[model samples]
Target: MMTHIVSKATYRTHMIALFMCLTFLWPCAICLYCTDFSRNVDHYCSFCNAFIGTYE
Candidate 1:
């Protein structure tokens, strides 16, 4: 009985991790697909962008 419960809990934890990874990465993937970095950099200059662009 305890083993069964543990297995079910483990399965649920794995599913949640999979969902979180997909949710976080899906937007990043879409952004990469839609934008060319050079064009995007000029138009999308937030403070963070300027910092990274200048430093890197």
Candidate 2:
């Protein structure tokens, strides 16, 4: 029973780490593909256009 609880906690920690990595790395991935580093008036990349649009 204690081992099961420990395993569950470890699994949750792994998932949290995975989520953090995705949250950080996803923008880096977009920036890597971007040609223009300049930000528009809204402070987003002009080359990529929209953040949501990038996902699509």
Score each candidate by Cα lDDT.
0.36, 0.36
Per-residue lDDT of model 2, residues 1-56, tens digit only:
11111111234344545665688865544443242232221233445544322211
TM-score of each: 0.28, 0.28
* Candidate 1 lDDT tens digits, 1-56: 11111111234344545665688865554444344422222222343333232211
* Model 1: CA > 4 A from native: 1-9, 25-56
**Candidate 2 residue spans exceeding 4 A from truth:** 1-9, 25-56
- Candidate 1 has an lDDT of 0.36
Error of 1 at 19 (Å): 0.2
